[model samples]
Structure formats: C-alpha cells, structure tokens
Target: MTDQTEPVGEVDALMRQAALDAERLLSGLRMFVALGLGLFFLVAVKPADALQEPVLLRQWAFAGSTMMGYFLLGLLTWILSARGLFRMWGVWVVATADTLFVLSGLWLSLMNTGLEPGAIFVFPSAWLVPLVLAFAVIRGDPWVMAFTVAVLCLGLALLAIGGAESGQQGRRETLDLFLSLPPNVMRLAMIALAGIVLVTAARRVRRLLLRSIRDARSRANLTRYLPAQLADDLGEVGLAALQRGSRQEVGLLFVDIRGFTGMTQEMPPEKVSEFVSDYRRRVSAAAEKTRGIIDKFMGDAVLIVFEGDGAARRCLDCGLMLRADIADWSKARTMRGDAPVRVGIGMHWGEVFRGVVGDANRLEYSVFGDAVNIAARLESLTREMEMDVIASRDLIATAKAEAGSLGFIDLEPIEVRGRTGALALSGVAKDAPLRSAGTAAPVSGSSS
Candidate 1:
C-alpha cells in the first residue's frame, strides 16, 4: 500500500476534488445558459432578418458556435467528473476556453460592424468582457481570475491597435464624438483597474474557501479514525443507536512510545509538541496501511481497533509496520544528533462491548473488555522483556498464520499484571518483516 507521508499533498488533493465538484455543478448551469436561455435572448435582442446578410450570418454562426462549444464543454466536464477523471488542469482549461469564446464573439463583431476599429469598444458586445471575467470568481482561484483578465486585456489591446492601423479610416458619425484614441485608452485603463479589483475579490473569496476546506478536512479526519459502521451504531444517522452497546469481536492494539515521559521532560514545550506530532504521524501511516482505526490517542500512546474477518492478521501487520517504520525514524533522528525513539506494540483479539454514550453535545465510542486491558498490559511488558512487539497466543491463533511465519516466535505463558493466570504469547523484534520467518522457540502455542 502507498504511504501518506506528507499531509500538505493530501490537503491540496482534497482542495482539487472540491474545486472539480464545484466546476461540475457550474458546468450544469453553463449548459442552461448556453442553450435555451441564450437563444431566447438572441432572438429578442436581434432581428431575424439581420442574420440573413453575409456579415450578420457570420456573427450569428460565431454565436451559435460559441453556444454549441459551451454546451459540449459542459457535458464533457460533467461526464469526466462522474468518472472521477477530471483534474485541476481541466478546470483552468475550461476557464480559458470560456474566456476565449466570449472575447472571440466580440472580436467577430468588429468585422461585422463596417466601422473603424475605434468603434469596437462602442459595440454592445464589449460589455461582456467584465461580466465574463466576474464569472471566474466562482472558481475560487485568484490565478484563474488573473488569467481571464490577462486574456481579456490582450484581446482588447490587439483590437484597438488593429483599429488604429486599419486602412479603412471610416467611422460611424453617431459615436465619433466619444470614440477617439484617448477615450479607448481610458476605457482600457478602466478594464485594467477593474481586473485588479476582481482579482483582489477572488483572493479574499479563495482564502476563506481554503480555510473552510481545511477546517472541514480536520473534522473529517476524525471520522476516518471512527469507522462509518461504528458511527452508524453510535446514533450519528439515527437517535436509536445512542446509549446502546453492541458486542463485536475485535483485534485490539495498543502502542506506547518508549521513554516518552523522560524525553519530554528534558525538551521544550514546542519541541515536545513537534516530536509528538511526528510520532503520531508515523503510527497513523502504519495504521492506514493495515486498515486499522486508531480508536484514541493520549500523547505518545494510541489505542487502535481492528474488526471483522482477519482482524488479528491486520492488527499484527499494523504492529509490525509500526515498529519497522519507527525504527527507521529513530535512525534518522540519531544521525541528526537528536535523541532516538522507539515504540512497543501489543495485540489481542477478543469480543468487546462497543457503543456510544452521552447526548448530542458530546459522544464517545468505547471498546471495553478484557481484550483492551490485556493489549495495554502486554505493551508495558515490552519494556521488561526487551521486545518491540508482543501478542497473546489467542490473537496469533486467530490470525491463522503458520509457525515460523509472520516473524512470530512461540513463547512461554507470561504473567500479566491485574491477571490471575499467565497467558500464552508470541514475540517479534523491531526489524523483522511481518511475513518473514524468525527462529521459533520450543514453547507450545496455537496456530501462529
């Protein structure tokens, strides 16, 4: 399984997904605007007879082409979004396409008017530039808004230059009073200033959107640790599930950082915080790989729960991965002249009481039984035994792995605190691979 080492990449990926979802919805609206509604406006605004002429015919065709392009693009984006094939680049491309089409329509108007290029700004289509640029603010990216503005300014500038250089100096008398080079330059300046305003607006909107998405993702991460089935059982979907307990066979895993208390006692608060965050991130990656849910964490210790079929197998894999990963981390720290770190993992498989408690204000999903207690106790045993990993015989047997497989070595029954009887167990080292063989002991045990 791929490991999630960098959280920033994950957050950026989430933002892209959110942007594509918004784009798909915007595409649906664009479909409506491009076809029926646009046609209604076209028919009411322009006389049908005018389109019969060659010049008007060309403009009409361009408008029709723009509409068709809009419809097709909208449909394509919707289909891609449905298939989960659309990417952030596609969003930028669509923004560029729409901007091109809007400006192209106005560009087509200059050829139809039979007037000087100075009259291009006087044409009614010129009003659409700002409106289309404003439309990009919905995209929630300041860069896309800036891109639209760049394209718009470039198109308008080219049109103005072409008008000044055109061989035909003829102009419409009605607009001659206000359509001089000075007025056109002033209008271009206004467009530039308006672009700045829109870009500023986009930045503010995008900042709020990113902040909201980050906050939502933080809350969503909690659900990842709390399984959906557990949530369903905990009254998130219905009130009936509240204050009720259900029995579930689960693989319980408990992890504790070796010497964490002493390590933190010597470090500053900021350093301790950074160290703990890094430690949790490492364990979380291992848990994610094994499909284990971290039920709860207290500073340097975490309680993970694996349920259903193969829970024991996954739990063991999680422990093995965690130990291996933490070992690598410790080595990296040692090379950097920082204090080394280690973790002890304990695993047990048994039935537990699982359920939620409290009101709408607060709720907790608690897994309580001998299984959890035994798992925590075994973790403490790791320090005394000089073992990085340990599991009860019952857990190993449930995994159904063969002896000398999965790095499991049979061990004599070990006395655990708060327990009257000694429990049969298995042990492994930090560097051992989960599926690799290890020297087995003569002590009797179950399948594992």
Candidate 2:
C-alpha cells in the first residue's frame, strides 16, 4: 500500500496556514476598531465640569483601559501568527480570552455607570460581540463559531439576569416611558438572529473550504501518475466526461530502457531505483517539451500519447529527443565507471480510444487500440534491429517531417507481430541534433 501521510500532512498544513491568515485579518480589524474608539474618547468628547463632578473623567479612564486591553490582545494575536502558532488551538484560546474581556468590561460599565438595560444597548462596546461573531464565521469553522456564540450568549444572559435583579425598580419605572420598544428583548433577539446567520454562513464556508482542499489534494495525487498538464486536463474533464469514453486519432510513443533487466541483475536494488528514476525524469522532460502526455509506466517502459493538432509531429520529435537524452546519459554513466545505459523508442499514429475505465470505485484513464500494440511491438523490435529509436513510416508521412530535417535513416518495411502486411519504418541515431522540418540534411548512418 502506498503511504499517504505526506500528502495528508501537506493538506493539513495548508488548512492551518489559511486559518492563521483569517485570524490575523480579524485581529488587524480589531486593532483598527480599538484605535478608532480610543481616538473618539480623546478628541470627540469634552469635559463639561459645570456641576463639578468627576464621573466623566472616571468613565473616560475605564473606556481607555478597555480599549488598551483590546489593542494589546490584537498585538498578541499578531505575535502568535508571526511565530506560526496561531492554529486551531490558538483560535479557541484567543476567542475565549476575547469573550472574557468583553464580558468583564461590560460588567464593570454596568456596575460603575448604573446604566439601565436600554442605555447599555447604545454603548460603543456592545457592537464587539457581533464583530467577534463575524470573525469566527470568517475562520470557516462551524465549531469555533458555535463556541463563540455560546460564550457570548451565556455571558450576556448572566449579565441580564444580574441587572434585572439589582435594577428591577429602575426598569419598572421606565417601562411606561418605553412601552412600544423594549431594549433588552430587542438586543437579545438581535444577538440570536446574528448568531443563526453567522453560524450558517460559517458552516457553508467550511464545507466549501473542505471541498477545495480535497480537490487540491486529488490534483496533487494525480500528478504522481500523470504529467502536471495532463492532471489539470483530467480535472477539467470532470466526472461527466470521464463517465463516457471518447475516441480520437492520437500519436502513440512507447519507450523502454534497453537491457534494463540484465543491468539490474548485477546492481543493488537502490542503484536500480536510481537508474529508473533518472530515466523517467529524462523521458518526462522530453515528452513535456514535445507536448506528449505520458499514458503509463509499465515496469521498464513508458507509454506516452500525443493528441490534438500535429500530434504525430510531436510524437516524432519526442522520440528524437528521448534518443539524444539517453545517449548523453549513457556517456555520463560510462565516465563514472557505472553501467552504460541505452533506451529504445517506438512511435506510431492511429485512432485510439481514450477515457476512464474500470468500476466506479476504481476508475482509471487509459488508451486502447491497435496503434498502442504496434508501438509496443516496434519498441521490442528495437533490440533486434540494434537501434535506439524507430518510428512507423505512416507516422513520418502524417507528420510531414522531412527525413533530411529529422536526420533519420529510412529503413526497409518490417513485419510486426499480430498485424497483417509489413509496416514501413525509419530509425534515428541516438545523438542526433534538433532541427526544423525542411532545413537540415540527414546524418550518414548504417541502416543495419
């Protein structure tokens, strides 16, 4: 079984980072609110001391202290984010602390000012609860939003109960003054409504984020078996396209590392893995450069396909590049006193059936047709012909690639296994140069 810890860990880390970013954004807004409130107290309100009372001065001091605490908490949030510790746990701790701060500040305001329930509703700090709720919702976690709402509601309920007990007479006296609108009831109602909306929004947002993370992880996993571009294309195809198979004329290219079995027989398993890894990387690079999509890796061979316009030309170009790349790799290995490497490639162009197959639970995208079989046979025949690269004559003709430009030697038609009539083909030397379709001349080589 393939170990999935690495990809899962990566997705988890991204989610944590996103959560931290949301926290920092909310913290910055909190700091701005604190600064605005502090400035309002210092600049907007005037001290009317005609009655020689110090109540206003004390009120200013309390408000300043509360705002200072808010600012400091925002700063702490920033510090935690900088240290990379503002994750889910940090969210719980910081949210709890903020609830306590707001509750304590409100309690002190009620005790000192003797404000009735109606007056408390108009206080600047009363809006902090909704702001905190908004922050929790933006964090995209339903549980965190639920916790914030519970704490806010519990604190407010406790305060309301205590206020009613102590100031029953005051509220009763004002009952006649404000008969149509009850501030306490309305305030609690608004809190409930906001919590419902915010929590619902948070739950929806959480679902979306979860889905996006899953999609990103799926794309990453696909790239492990397919090329990056092909993985992206598959994602765009979606479930509908995958459910229905499609057929199109495509260029098929098969590549196999020559004598790989004999080479690995004398080497350690680690060395064999290194050799295969290097070979696959080189093949992938060549395929990408030529716009070929790798179909699958069959042990020591790689099957790639090219579709869309000019696929045949792309397949031929990929084969030539693969030959050159392996030649360079073989020379480097020989210099290092390592086993010399060689690779074989076969290219053919024909109609291919391409789509997802297998059961619903194990659907796989694949290519199937006689063209694939012919490409495989040609790759196997490379060993018998003592050549590194071979392309079907039909592929060369379809691509309109000049033999001189491709620097390939035209070879006699050879019979392929399980196919009627002989198939004409051509071979290219491993160290050929890249050139356009009509400008360059062919390099002399034996057709042996």
Candidate 3:
C-alpha cells in the first residue's frame, strides 16, 4: 500500500510542477513574439532619400545605432525565452527592447531632414508596441506606466524640436506649422494625438492592473473562508458559475470546536480571534495536505469537501489524524496556560448540485440539496455521540472497502430534516491507528 501510494503522490506533485513550468514558458514565448514582430517592422523599413542627407545621416546614426541595439536586445530576449529563464527576467528583457526601440524612433524623428517627414510615421506605431507589451508583461508595476509616459514625453519633445529646426530652415514656421494647411497641421496633430493615446493607454493599463490586484486580494481573503482549491476555482470560474449546479459525488466533512461559544466568552476578543486563527491554520494544513477544499467557516466550525471516492476516504483518514493533531495542539496550549480546544467532526457523502449563486453585488459558490444538510447534521451529531469523528453510511458505502484498514465503525441510521428517508451513519475514532502515518489529510464538506 505504501509503495503504490508513494509513487502516485510523487507523480501528481511532478505533474503540477510541470504545468507551472509550461505556463511560464508560454508567457515568455508571447513576449518574444510581440517584441520580435515590432523589431522586424522597424529594421525592415528603409530610410527615405530626403532623410539621407549628411545632417540627417548624423541624426539617423543615433536612430540606426539605437535600432541595431534594439535588434540585439530582441535577440537576447529570444535567447532568454528559449532558455526558459525566470519570468521576471523574460518580461524585463522584452521591456528593455521596447524602450530602446521607442528611443531610437524618437532620435530618428529628431534628426529628420524636412525633406522626409514620412520617416516619422513609424515612431507612433513603434512606441505603441512597447507600451502594450509593458502593460502585458508587468501590469502590476507602476514603473511600466512611468516608463511608457517618459517615452511618450521624449517622443513629443523630439517632434517639437525637429519642427522648430525645420521652421528656421525656411521649411515652415513653428506656430504656423501647427495651424497651417492640412498635411503639416495633421502631422503635428498626430504627434499630439500619439501622446494623448499613449497616456490614455497607460491609464487603462493601470486601471486593469488595479482591478486584477483587487481581485487577487479578495480571492486571498476569501481563501480564509474557503479552501485554497475552492478559492482558486472561485477566482477563475466565479461564484455565480459554480452555484449553477452540477451532479457529482462528494464527501463533506464538518468540524466545530466543542464548547466554542463558552470558550470565546471566556477569552478577550483579540485572544478569541487568535485562537480561531490558530485552529484554522492547523486544520487547514491537514485538509490541504489531503487535497480538500474548504467550503466555509461558520463561527468555530469549518466545512470541507473532497471530490472523489478515494479522496473522500483520504479525507476521513485526515479528519481522524486532525483530531489527534488538535489534541496535541491543545496539550501544548494547555501547558502554556492557554485555553485548550476540542473539535467534533462529521463526514458524509452523496450526489449533490454545486454552483455559485448571488446577485451582481454579491455572490457565493455553495452546494445545495439534502446531502449538504445531512452533512451538517452529522457534524452536529458528533457532539451528542461523544465521538470525535462520525461518518455517514453514504461515505462508508462510497469509500472503497479496503479503507477499513483506516478503522471505521458502522452506526445507526439518522433521519435528517428536509430528507424523507432515514440515512445510516458510522463513526471513526480519533485514536485509530493508521496503516501509514504520513498520508496527507483530504478535503471534506460542501463549498459554500
């Protein structure tokens, strides 16, 4: 049993790690593609004859050198992407390339010989690529927005300086150029428009980043109420989606502190909070270890759910282990003169509909029907039976028979509210010996 379980556990861990690696690799590839395409457009386009003059060449050299540098930077980006370097580094490499490209375009526009203003056309488009890339790569970082704004300002400054220089050369007057006939005025208009667009884009990016950050923070906070798995699922699919309903067999486990109300009354609010936090941490660790999703925490109680039959058995095993852990934890607290805590847990299994339900303003992913209610009742039963752990007959029947190695006892039938038929239940001792001591606790309970 140990041999079989060990390899399976190792394999699952490996698979998860591999999936994360693949996602990072894909992100790197996306950055590379965006940078590569932008660079290609800049490098492939030839300089016009009018801008080929000696004065312009000297100016174009700055642009040319900058472009070549960006090309090399893009090459470096590809190398990092291909090598699958760190995600932060990959993002930075592309960001750097983009900055250089925008800088080069600005330099070229500055040195523009009035004869070929057409060369300035690429600056706006080129700058846009990096701005977009920066938003994509490091949306959380305000520095990306700062850098984008800096680039926009630099581009505007160059255009203004070039326009002034052209005016002195009898090409056109600066203010008149701004108000003059459609073409030159349009060119000036475009430069102004580009700055506005870039700034707007940056603001939009910042807003998007803030929204993402808020969502992440909310999800993190929600994880305290729900299991990490369910929290993540809620973040991805949303509470409304999950509440819609699905038929799947699930093992539900409920755990509540014995005499929790009395304990809280005896302690200060801060201490009560600390006590609850500590209990949650210990139980959550065990549940997560068994791949359990916490549904919710109601006062001193925690609801956990495990997905599959095998997982359900694992959850039951974990729950029993958790009881022992809690006992030890309580002993440690008692030695420290802190209040000791006792928990009663119950497990049940049945087909149920699970989904998210709520209005636009609020939402929650929760399970529905008699199965969930029965699980809650079973948890209540634990306090009455003087047992630390109880399991419904549904859980026992669904779990593989070999699970008997974990030590479960058959119990009398229980009639629950809202359900017409009586349901059989069982009990498991907290002190039950394990076949293997290190198995992780599994998740149990409805996610609500």
Model 3: lDDT of residue 104: 55
Which numbered prediction scores highest in TM-score against the true structure? 2
RMSD of each: 10.8, 14.7, 12.7
> How many clashes (backbone atoms < 3 Å, residues ≥3 apart in a chain or on different chains) does model 2 have?
0
Q: For residues 1-448, could you state the per-residue lDDT of candidate 3 as single tens digits? A: 0112344575565545443343343344334434553344344433563154454444435544654564465455556545765455444445555555665555455445443343344333344444444333333345655665675566656654453244334344422322334324323433443454446546655875698799888777665544456654565456555666577778888898999898788788898888889888887887877777777778888888777537667667667767767877877888788777778888888777766556555555567667777778888887787777788766766665443555566677877776679887777654554333234333232111
Candidate 3 wrong stretches, greater than 4 Å: 1-227, 234-240, 243-247, 268-270, 308-310, 334-340, 359-362, 401-403, 416-422, 430-448
Position 122, candidate 2: lDDT: 50
lDDT at 56, model 1? 49
Residues 1-448 of candidate 2 have per-residue lDDT tens digits of: 1122344676677778778887886677567657765654555434453124343455556767888988888888988887877767888987887788777767765665565644544544565687677767777777888998899998888776674224444544333322323323434443554465466557757877799999878767655544554554555556456547788888999999877789999888898898889888888888888877787888889999898777888888788766666766777777788887788888898887987666644556689998899999888878888777788888989998876567778777887666789998888765555443223543332111
| Candidate number of the best lDDT | 2
Residue 8 C-alpha lDDT in model 1: 68
Number of the candidate with higher lDDT, 1 or 2: 2
Q: In model 1, what are the clashing residue pairs, if there are any? A: none
Task: List pairs with backbone clashes in candidate 2.
Answer: none
What's the lDDT for residue 37 in model 2? 57
Query: What TM-score does each of the candidates earn?
Result: 0.50, 0.54, 0.49
- Can you give the lDDT of residue 395 in candidate 2? 91
